[model samples]
Target: MPHRLHLEQFGPVHALPVLHYRLEFAHLVREAVRRVKPDCIAIELPSTIEAPFLRAVERLPEISVIHYEGRQRRDGAESVYLLVEPADPLVEGARLALERRIPLRLVDVDTDSYPRHVEALPDSYAIHRIGLTPYYEEYRRAAASVAPGREDRRRERGMAWRLQELAKEHGSILFVCGMYHLERIKDDFGRPQAAPLERVRRQGVRLFNLHPDSCREILDEFPFISAVHELRRGPLPPEPDDRGETLRKRFSAFELIVGGRKDLPAEELLRHAVERGARHAGRGEEFPDRQRIIFRLFQEAARHYRQETGDPVHLWQKRAFFRFARNYALASGALLPDLFQLLMAARGCVDDNFAYALWRLATFYHWQRAEADIPTISISPEEIWGGSRRIRFRPRERRRKGLSHLGFLKRKKEKRPGEWLEGFTDPSICSYPPEDVLIEEYGRFLKKKGAMQLSEELSRTEPFTSSLLDGIDLRETLRNVADGRVYVRESQRAKGGVGSVVVIFDEDRENGNYPYRTTWLGEHEQESDMAFYATPPEDNIVGPGICRCEYGGFLLSYPPRRMMDVWRDPDYVFARSKPEVLLLAALDYSPEKHVVHVAARPPRSIFRQIAARMGKKIVHIPLGSLSSVKLKSIRVLHILHGHDKRQVAKDYIW
Candidate 1:
């Protein structure tokens, strides 16, 4: 059996040693304080920096770090940092003490003489399985292997001495210190040895809020863990019911950001995630590490991906993604990958959109408003409402006086001034890769809709007491077991192939509105030949010469031929408007007898007559019949005319 540490056993001075990296430890500390109600609280920070540190703690949700620069033993400079997030045990302890009107003492050795060495600690989550004392024992073995030096011993003795003095005044005093120093402090509990103290001049000391981007580096837990800790106001409990509530609350915040129905509860999703995480971790005597919650989040992301793309994440893909994430975690020097690492892995293994969903779900909790009075940093205009502020610890570099005029002039100049044409490039020569991916995705959507539209008239009836036979409807037969009757109905296999499609987004003859027309040869033979007439790219530039334009009309010829040049074809000159030209070209190039036309209405009589002369037919499908949002997305296509633009196209493409 594993041994658990008991705080009450230690009498007036109950030493609760903690490993800082695990958020669970912080919660444990908070629980101890609540149970013991110590008269005075002693934290493991130096007395010299209590004011600024406490001030930063008082400002809770606005995460801040203590930055101090002190003289080195050899005479140079050494920097020390301590991040104070709401989940931090020391910060929480201090806050609790302050809230309860208990005296909070900073009792560790001064920062200048504090041991600067770092040792890799065991995973804090292990405490859930092996119990606290056993985990601490393991940690002690790991730290002793590294061996403490004179400075380490001095710091321990000094903290011990401080605790001894505090116990004399307060009936019950609690001391929260590093796990490695705990055993040593107990050994020197009653000794009357002179404690070492180094009183160096206080160097540069400033308090700066922690930047969101740097949270992964300085914080002990995943941002999601930190977020949940903030919401629950403690570490996650081992009980299934409590865990479910916490998980649901976290995902509920995520759902709101992703535009889920405001009234719909996220409990079902959270329940599914927890069950799956437990399964994945394998059942044993110990509970799985809390990191398993990440798997649940990815599952949620996968569901979202299916909803958006109509595809499910394959089993192999999920395995590969976790493997890749683990490799990244190892590279990041962490026992498990956090959201940042997971996002990076997702981008490479999946796509940006999938990774983007994961990021949104993980970060949603950070933006949620605290229901009670909690410490939070002031929001900035750029941070968005309910969003954490972006800050940096590093000082901003001062610009030289000589270059100040240029900055002043740059600020004075209007951005994207119509008068300034120097930076503007030809739209036909530049490309936006993302726009290309969007167009491709929209094309796939169109193909699916066209197939469905071709079979729109056909209806399926099963469990045949009613209609003619098509096939044995096994699904209906299984569903109606009470009747035990077989049903069948009329069915037609989808046949009308959409060899070519012409889309006239602007049904009206507004030819003058679309000033630019461009033709693009497909990069590969499998792609379609395309010609489009839309707004001039130069006037609506997104990047350099890359411009976004609405599609007045377009022609798509599949199994593209090198001779397919619809824009310059004199055969289409007879057509009056861009839509007419595109319709004519689509009818002419379609290999199939019928062509799909997506427009406000059927083509003009002349175009129909031309199609009839060529022994071809047109299938008219209203533009509104298809998803408007999807069509609108594809209506805007980017054109790249030069090699310079095409060379870098892959970067912008998904």
Candidate 2:
């Protein structure tokens, strides 16, 4: 609703005072200006700074600041800077007036006399739900309850007097000021009492460029909100719609951050997430509310983090990470976390690289770099955006030659004869092999996941209660409690231990990245015999001869000596693929009836027939079904020099 000025002495001017924090205010002011089309526009800023302030507005999306020295009081010097952000409503409204060539008046007292006060106010966004009149009424009532400040009343009367003079010059006008001062300004309109505008000595006025990274610090809204405001090239509502714009922008950002790698799966995952969130929105409501949209984007980014680095971020972990982010926002006196806070929380809760994914998702705005020909000045983003930090960069000294060292200059060279060193590559000297620890841990994890599959295969029978079968079925018993009956369970004997295990990361011909392959003999006689294909540890020596290798295909069979080097065995020539040979070898070595085959897909019918011929059944466990992160960790194995090196290896294995 338009704010009508009903003063008998002052003509028909709309006094439109607006809250400055939200992007909605920019839109509100824009609409008000278009609708009223008043004969003249009156703004709250002083006439002296108006020219440069408007110039700063023209320089955006290349942000600039208006710096002017305030009245030099006897106590100290004071200076004021008006950050010309894209989302400021007063600036936006003024820009519209200038564009339309409306006669404009600067009505408020100059900056030198303006008094600043602190007040904790409710969220300005609530005005989107409630009309401006109601919001102002609530604000006015609250103000009346508290003792008014002398400085505030003086400022209101000054503005009111200025508005009256402006109304005398123009038939109708629009006055834009702070919401807190408008009610009192109206009460003092056309009154004989007038507050004298203070005049004092002023200093140099200048404009400074604002860095893109510093936009968040100086702007009223979060960096992400400013980013969105820029992307839309206009103000967005409190709860805006997500029409795949975020997905497209984030994907572009992800590609740029990752150096132009197109990730179709990640893109599809985010698209599906947005679609799912849209389904939960109310009818006729904007699909995928902004908050929900951001949540889903973060979730999809986490999933992509897993795909890229083999680190799974569980749903609970995501929840906890955002909880920390929100807390950071609250500590910073913001309603929600900005991109910087979210990235900081993600890095602490997740990993350093994982936060990179979130940052890419959050800071991307399509219109950030417009092709406008506007002149821009340069300033370091660090100088403005460095929060609570004082950073300085200086030229570093050049590196000196090694021989330039004073001690090295005085040293003399000594020669020694070349001789063979013992135990350099001997495997027997290693006390504990890292492969053994990795295999044992991985086998434990596989067994845990496989237990569920085993239970699914088992049959449950309901008969007269005998002992507890599979531990008393508490859920079943509780369901029948009202019927006056107690239910019990029977335990079944398991077939055998997880004796034979085959883990294949990728199908044959797909293991291009993992080129180096080898088989290692078990250092411990009690441990399971293993034969596998992996990246050679010798290629990546972490410590001396200790090398890290990723397993492309592996076979672990318990009861030492049951498994042989399937890679070297010539009798397995009938197998068409490398993984097939491992699978065939696992089946041939397994003394038990079933062999666990973990891969993306189940083995072909020929492998099943071959296993059946050998009186062994193959238990197919989809590798994708298990946690990729756990599997990736398990696949990483370190090769030690020898068994004698076990003590040293133990320290580095974990």
Candidate 3:
């Protein structure tokens, strides 16, 4: 594929020992140069490719030479990295030009002085993305609600423009760049703007490239799917007709699934459902949908609602749906060969919502598949891979009683009969404990001890809520944001696992909402941040000022009754280390705690007494072994594995 000018080959380059293959490539290049014996020998690649190009190009320096390269990221971090990598391609090409004593021309985009923007200083040509942020957000979404494939077409014309720009400045002997990019380079936006080869010929400038057979090894090796892209894709296609009443029927099916009653129209219902979703988030609460709610969304957007179940009501769902869908399609291409093929067949058959859903499912299949690590064929040869699916959805079941329990409660509220709103109609209207109302009415309630406010002696807490503090100190500020009562300073940062609930539903595992993801609390959000992360109220054993942290599922906190105070009032141990008993007592039920293990080397009687105060016991054994400790009602068996670790395995008992 070399240009028709006298061809030359340069050989025996690189640090590798003069092996047969190494010498062969050098010999090939040397011969290509010898035939061309014209003024200058121009090689390809940037200056940093290797020293061989420098040596060869210099050998025939009667001709001028040049090197070429591309650009990468533009931020400060990437700048330092570029210094080491030298991302240019004209090294060997320029070295040959210099060695042949020929003239040289170097060409490429430069972002040395300014930050790289999508459309700024594009070396590949004038073509580029108009905006940056939207492009960045494209990959964040799991679905391809937007056109996810236009990036490849954009890269092509940009390169052509850059080359032409370079050609205008230099003489008839300008070499564009690497063969791969040059091959795909289009003179215009692929809309039949004259071909690159035609233009290069008009200028009387020759072009060169590599053959397909020569580069087959590399083409066969790498996978071409876009992973973690920073691209701005074009807009999405218009939605097609859903085939007679098929779309209507499918929408109805989803409506029936989420809402027990199927009478309501889909669009209006979706708005109101979103309103409910908003209300939950406004209070910083996770929206736990009733089964009725679930069935409604499923009926409307069956595939979509399934994934939206666990994500926050924020923009994450909409964004993730597209990204996940695209990735799934790419990874599942081999498994679901008909994916894009089927997509292309029907052409405009899918809507943004359902299309995003399908695409999201296909994308996430990588981790979801049992054998993600195993590569398989994505598109099959036999698959015609076109035409749209008329996936009519039908609800598996429906709830018979929608708020039947609230019927009498609405009657008791004494509203005009026709205007009555039942309990299920709205949950926020339901009554709170007397203390909440009292606090709202009388401020923080205090026992009027000797006509003095003793409210400071007690406090209340809500899950993930902090107590009200005025002119706060360290104790109240950190709260559940971190662990313990370690003194903190101004501008201190504390972050912990934020979203924790045992709510059961769909989309929990897939979206990373469950198991867990770390949400943050910086030194900002002030008192409210602490209040929301650690809402402390009165009457909890999490005693005085602030106490134990109710983080995630368990409490890593001290006994509410202070060690000093509880020591004076030993009966208080029931509220401190024994919250299990304390909670049962709150519910008027009694549970037992067993001192299951007696240490093999029993502690001193005085130590035993102190440990016993915290619900432990000590016992003696002759040998170092601890098989002697037996128990009843103990679920966690902690056997001593050695020092500092435990062999915690389930101990089955008869």
**Leading candidate by lDDT:** 1
RMSD of each: 17.6, 12.0, 27.2
What overall lDDT goes with each candidate model? 0.62, 0.60, 0.25
C-alpha lDDT of residue 391 in model 3: 33
Candidate 1: worst-modelled 10 consecutive residues by lDDT: 244-253
Candidate 2 off by > 4 Å:
1-11, 71-76, 111-116, 129-134, 169-172, 190-195, 216-218, 234-352, 359-654
Model 3 CA deviation exceeding 4 Å by range: 1-327, 333-386, 390-590, 594-654
- Candidate achieving higher lDDT, 1 or 2: 1
Alpha-carbon shift of residue 106 in model 2 (angstroms): 3.5
- TM-scores, each model vs. reference: 0.49, 0.55, 0.18
Candidate 2 lDDT by residue in tens digits, 232-344: 44333234333323321112222323333343443344434334433432233221233544575576567656555534575556777889987987887755565567777
lDDT of 3 by residue, 1-654 (tens): 022122111121111101111111232233344444434323332223334334333322111112222234464232111100001224333445654566653322222223322321111100012222232233224222433234333444444454454444433333423322333442242333322221121111111121222111111111001100100011222332222221121122222234322333333333333333223321122112222222222233443333332111123333443344345445643212233432232122222334443333222211112122222112212221123244332222222376544232222211222221111122111111221233222211111110121123233233323432333354554665565433322232122111111111112223322222111121222110001111121111111111111111111111112112211234435432222222212122101121111111332355345435644322222222211111111111111112211111111100
Q: Which candidate has the top score in TM-score?
A: 2
